[model samples]
Target chain A: MKRITIITGHYGSGKTEFSINYALDLMQQGKKTALVDLDIANVYFRSRERQAFLEEAGIEVHSNIYHSDISADLPAIAPSIRKVLENHTYHTVIDAGGNETGAMILNQFARHFLEEEHDMLYVVNANRPETRTLEGAMYHYHRICDESGLRISGLINNTHMLRETEAADVLKGYQLCHEISEKEGIPLIYSCCTEEILIKLKETDAMPVDFNPYRIRLYMRPSWLDR
Target chain B: MSEKQLMKGNEAFAEAAIRGGCRLYFGYPITPQNEIPEYMSRELDKVGGAFVQAESELAAVNMAYGGALTGKNVFLSSSSPGIALMQEGFSFMASAEIPMVILNVMRGGPGVGGIQPGQADYRQATRGGGNGDYHIPVYGPASIQETVNIIYDAVTLADRYRNPVIILADGMLGQMMEPIILPEARETVTEEEIRIQKPWALLGHQDKKERTVVKSLRLQPDDLENHNNKMHEKYIEMMEELPQYESYRLEDAEVVFVSFGSMSRIVREAMDHLAEQGIKAGMIRPISLWPFPNKAFDEISPKTKMVISAELSIGQMMDDVKCAVCGRFPVELLYRTGGMVPTPLEVVEKTKALLEVTK
Candidate 1:
């Protein structure tokens, strides 16, 4: 079973940062990694940069611009999708667009690939659109499942906003995602982690999956990091 | 391998669903297609599968939606009106990019028009029927064997593309019986294997690492435009790679006839009559409506003198043929409506008339 992890969330959610770090982490863990830019819907924290960087780090990348002024002229990327699924050997992580509309491109491209066996993970920032409340999150989930023809397998609570985010918000988002999980018939797979927040969230009940920063550390770590 | 047994087109679809790994069936009884759901109700239980006589076509499609959510190979059967009721759900299914098959045993349209066969819904099936710019891979099978084969292909294509696939057959195909050799079922990947492999699905977490979402809402114009561009890309990809059609005696022919579904059968008979009369003619049938072999018509336009499109509708496929020919050659339509099919004699007469006018 070749595993392809897709890291997605609403606009302004920290899905891109988490995606970059996660792909590098998997690579550090001795796995082949491929990161795809599925964010044709948003540009604030685009994934195309990660495409070149990931490739430089010996990871494959899929970045096709399907949304642009010359939109109708864009060649369909099914052949590329087929190639990636057929040839890949490592974990592939697609950084889908902000909303379901944007993410639908990936779903359309990989529709054949999303069978009963595939895993689709939704990144939830409690502050994001259509996900502020449990009911809102469930609405987004149902809509996404219906549009993409891909069943969502789990959720990743990544509630955050620049430096304004606190450990408490992550836990709150986790709980909200958990409530929505009952409606969607899936679970929150993991929660985003930060150094200060991880220590603060340690006492919290929501299980947080440690986002691997080792691969990024090998290339370029954040200015604040002391390795 | 016993000899191919004669079976109704609807029964062929039912049997094909079983052979194609469709383990779940959800449908409400409708005229012409009732036998399909009835057959499924009886056989699904014996095969350790799930079958539900949904409260209505609306419920049936949604239940199939539930079955599809479970990553099960699922199917739903309905007639024209019932299919109309399923449009809302189909739009959702199309937007979600779920891979499933829908068997539309088409009857007359607008309301509960008639129990008789009609291709009037050709426009509705090819065009997006619900709110949203969505498309389903539509296949019009002309025979019982094609009914089974198209169902088999529809499931595989839907699963392969992760989009809903429609098997568009009229009441003639659904109610009529013919001999067919059913194919053996192929081994498919299990849902658990899919769960393990495609980590983007909405399955509950096995290992908590990050949250994933599935959505299609793009609030901004640029964002939405980009999403639409992506869909166009998918359509182009299907056009170039998956255009499905069958052409007979097209080479070195002066007159070419275009038809689909049951009308194609009549076209074939007409072509045969033309052949016996020593009047050179050919025929082309489109099995897939979305990818619509427009390029095929374009390729042969220069060589052909006259092209006639015969359909069960006023002229649904004529739009496609006209678009393809681009007035490179003379294009004409031989159409019938109100659920009544034109016979081979009628089609032959139209073909002769077209040839005379153009030549």
Candidate 2:
């Protein structure tokens, strides 16, 4: 297991959703885990939105990160985050913000984690406006690295369009991510989809997809959607 | 024609702009349209052009205004909220009678709405978003291929009237991929060519003529009024040119769907499904939403008894559709707002229900 994993992507790319579930996935794999919210760019749909649920599941949660306060736009790096990463025994998963504006906050504290073994997972929702094409996806990747002073270690394909997402949508996203992963020489850390899609994939292999895809439950939703 | 390559709408917009002799590009990041600036930055560098990812949409539009004064065809793209921020600059460009090509890859909104395809900006685009007595000739292309062609003409059209022109597309078109035959690259407009063509362009007085000024501010009320009247005359000339719209299967139809942009493409699918069910229907797609091809309504078959405004918004474009029909036919609205697209089946069902009730 990676010592520390940072998840970042374009705004509304569903990085926060992937971050929350990824921490749970770590816990399920029998690893001591802690989730950290370093998102300061977006005011809604941060990893902290589910802090209560995460804590209830016996996972440690770090909230109010990046100098957070009632004023939502300012960037302030919290020093306690380094303490969590230093706890060698536990795996730390930090959910970075939507784009460069959010990921740039890490530049302030890059020194503490520079030597530590960490994987910067660039989460991409192929359907989102920012990652609709290869050039667009590459631009965001470069911007995040330029801002945070960190290199992306892997690519996570988590393309979706909320409840309207379909099997075809899943395949479209996988195709782009698969090509990018090959060209960039980065690992495709499993394409993400709901369990329903997995069942569909099993019935017929119309388009080719790399194995080792992760099944995800939809956790990123507005409160009005919850029944 | 070059072999068709699979291209996203935003990428096609950039490629089309570059081929149209647009060198100076000013843009900011916004969803559904970020690919535009991303493509421009990489591709423009190769063409010896300048591409600045401005800090904000406000700054980007202003930069575009300055670039236009230099007599180069300038390009800029933004989504709904970001376009809202650039309204002031657009107004300035219109008043100065400067030529510019702008693209608004619209998303759902009144404010910072969802990053999904929306046509709520119909009024914003056609009626003019900026504060002014001006109308920005807005072209609404429904497909990726059409986006390329329209952007090609939009540049010339902007120069023809010395006014700002907008390619008003939506989020779906921006993100969707389609095989499009790229147009032949046009020769870039050189400094010498601009100097000769645009006599009023603000290239410093090289001891040949008096200094040229490009300013929107007119201190005297009479001067501003005269300028506004001149703009109205240009608009009259634009209207006389005869706007474009696609009439699909309008003959022998009893109902017609009025729509544009990505929504119009979806409506075409719905029309096909309606045909499959033996429900004869037609479509009137407004290519230029600003000039609004209202004359198409006169071409509707006498058998046409109803019109449905199939839009991506809650009946915003319905206003124009109403005027087009002029109460000759009952017009109903079939729409979904805030990132939810109108499905083909939903539209087919909605049209059938409206037909049944009206009958």
Candidate 3:
């Protein structure tokens, strides 16, 4: 995570989860953090659901829809989004939804962070076919850049298979994304996985740097995991 | 369908649907089910069939009805909110007694809830989400293999009774990847068979027999009553002939747990835990949620003191459980709502607590 991190990826690539984890990590590091839920294209798993928990951790949170009513379906991006953009002092993570549907919304807020040093990170999941290769990852990356007019400064390897993800699987995604980052000239800022999987990489040489990546815990638990 | 492949659950169902002789698919994009259309658009096209991305679910179902009217096996799929929009078309299809297969990759909902799997559409699927006194035959499958088999079999069942069939699967079953042995593929419905069987097909009579009218409308009071009675008779036949359920370790166990779909798999785990602790527990899983599989209710163990309706919804299937039990035994509900799935240990703890209170 950086001064300002805008997270966007293909649908089911887990962008919101990445954004939530990055914001929490920044807060744990004793930095002022804020997560903006610019996910108007999707209703489920929006970052807004964790607002109270994030606020309890002493970080500000903004939702795309302000109404507590689920049926409201109004496109009210929190006014706080603009406020967060203006400040630039607090670590801000803007969570975008999947596909061009989600990236198009970022166009409105993309111009705000041009003056600041920002990293719009494309979270790539290798398990999905769309982001499995450089071409697949670039398809959405180019579209997000084209739609938002905001360049992706870095890439994050956030591979998963729901609860079935293993360390090897995450490593496979990291290798693929690392190449994409290198070819595209964007830095590979992080390779995220659950603390358990992350711990597996501790003794291995899978990571680019020993302690550079963030340890992410699974936040969205859909039914049928048998847990 | 044959040979095992580690395919995503949604793609498995789509492939199986095509093999089941489904020629046309009309659907809109929604999470947990996008793979169905994605796979269908690619594969169905290869089979010399068509996949049309409809403007809306409302349009999708109507397009399905139009396709099915021509006596071609048509398929359509959508998630909760999208399914909600297709209710009216479902009703009209039922009134006309048209044959079509629809898959509901269910999501959390009373409104725009979570994208995670939830069994909240139990009533909407079984009891009919659309208007009129109609019953949509719904199958709640627990596995990818079962999902493939059901999607394959559902097309024929829908055609057999000339009624719509809904494969009510959750997002977990749709999103998870699993190796499955596909069912033997069924040949595409031939035009000759359509002419002989579905004489009501809109594929022009060729001046041979009287032109047919395929519609739900019968303006006259007597005619409409006759149509309704005919549809009702088919539902009764479905209830009598199409009740399919599973009874697991249920012979002499106590505290029979009644569950369905993905929730039953977890309950099986909970049953294992109970057995390890010397608590004999069994399960009655209704594969077909509509007919309620009331027969499984009679198989409740003699040692059973409580019938637990464990599910992912806040007691949606419990209503049917209570009805089936009909006060003959104490029926308890153990459920988790809002896309939250309970673990096997959690279910065991809850069951033990309920058992203690009942004791």
Candidate 4:
């Protein structure tokens, strides 16, 4: 069965970037991968908008929109989803909209996995709305869980600054993940590290890392790179 | 086992947990059920187990999630409000088929009611207290011995089906101490055994084997329907496999008294009163409320005329009794909530009234 991975997070939590890069890496490794843009919250900067970038790299990119006029109604995309699950043999990466309002698309697709088709990852940035505090992140966790009928299997910490990202910020993100992993009962599966910086953040905690199949290539248990 | 012991319900639960071979307990202390965590803190070290008063109920339940995922005999304890906070994790445990035990030494609620014993949580416990379409097997023990036995069995049942099990007691059961026999300790699997047993549990997939993802996400309509159907099938199987009941002269009685947990003890005493009054009353106390003893009443309804359900809530389990009896027999409910424990005399009076109405 094709592995389905859902990437979701609070607003401005780098879910799109992570999803795009992860899908790119998976495809590069000869894994048949597809990226679905389910980001309904942010109108612009959606990974869906960069379909050409993915398709040109010999990958598949599907937008979450079914009808241009009725994009928000999740039921509209069910038939297309049914086709994909039935016909496609690709590593399906679902880039969910940020926050609770955007992740509502999950409910529409809920009927698809009667046999448990996918694993959900709740991407987090200690800096995002409703995720700044531990309590706030928990509330969002419950909200998505209650609404989507899906328990977050793992977490992705993309706590960083767009231009002024630092190693300290990355470590802070790991601390938050550590606290969440202890409390939520799910492991901190991985954190995204880009090629723009060196591995300056020490692995002070047990939460693992995902190198997004880029510059980092060592598949060590602590910081495993997909490539 | 000695005679009645002067112990609190929470302390009894803690002792019962130890007797049940519970090696890991994660909890955040709330009123009424705080003694459970306190006792665990004191006792876990002696048993070479681990206990943590988590940052919050959220963390405690999640830690329970990890422990359950690891397939260890684990438990998490809390009161009503705390259980409410852990509902999401509970649902996750249920769906993921994570086997673990939970003890809700219930206190009054509707949003932090009081630290008093209240059966008002009946709805939340019996129904889906957690989100989604799932049910957790619930066991209500009437006495401290029953608490020990049920906690032990909760662990067994949870692992047996790979689902979460809850022991729903009240403040009275948690705080009150009666004569109890601690069972002989059984061998439980270690963390290494856990890693060996469930290779699918997210223990950092170093095996380079096919990644076994344990998630409850069903995105397709047909697939979701199939999942629900499978869950229903398991529930049906549970109904056939796990229904338990205790009968007090039910074979020859005219009216059957239905109650559970602490309330059934009162009904037991009430049955004695009814016997002296020359009333043919028997009690049907359900030990497992979810896989409800539906068949028990089906077999008993033909022999009995009326069923009187005495509960702490208005009539949560009464509906189950009615459904179980196929709605052919008349079922009446008698209850007192908000930390009220009905006396034996009160139950006898209510049983008499129910008999009159059925007649």
Candidate with the greatest lDDT versus the true structure: 3
lDDT of 2 by residue, B98-147 (tens): 99999999887879987777888888888887887988888888887898
Error of 3 at B102 (Å): 2.1
Worst lDDT 10-window in candidate 4 chain B: B1-10
Per-residue C-alpha lDDT of model 1 across residues B1-359, encoded as one tens digit per residue: 33344344676789889888899998887777876887798888877788888889899888887677766778888989999999988888776667789888887666878667789888888996888888887888777777788788777788777778887898877755454678787565576876764444566665888875545556798987877777777767777877778888888778888888887877777777888888888888888887788877755736778888888787887888888788887778898876666777877787787777765
- Between candidates 1 and 2, name the one with more favorable DockQ: 2
Model 4 residue B236 lDDT? Answer: 74
At residue B145, give the lDDT of candidate 3.
83
What would the DockQ be for model 2? 0.05
Q: Which residue runs does candidate 2 get wrong by more than 4 Å?
A: A1-227, B219-225
Per-residue lDDT of model 3, residues B97-163, tens digit only: 8999999999888897877889999988887877788898889999888888989989889888888
- At residue B304, what lDDT does model 3 achieve? 75
Per-candidate TM-score, chain A: 0.78, 0.90, 0.90, 0.80
In Å, residue B246's CA in model 2 sits off its true spot by 0.9
- Candidate 4: TM-score? 0.58
Structural similarity to truth (TM-score) of each candidate? 0.58, 0.66, 0.78, 0.58
Runs in model 4 deviating more than 4 A are A1-227, B1-8, B301-303
List the candidates ranked by lDDT, beginning with the highest. 3, 2, 4, 1
DockQ of 3: 0.10
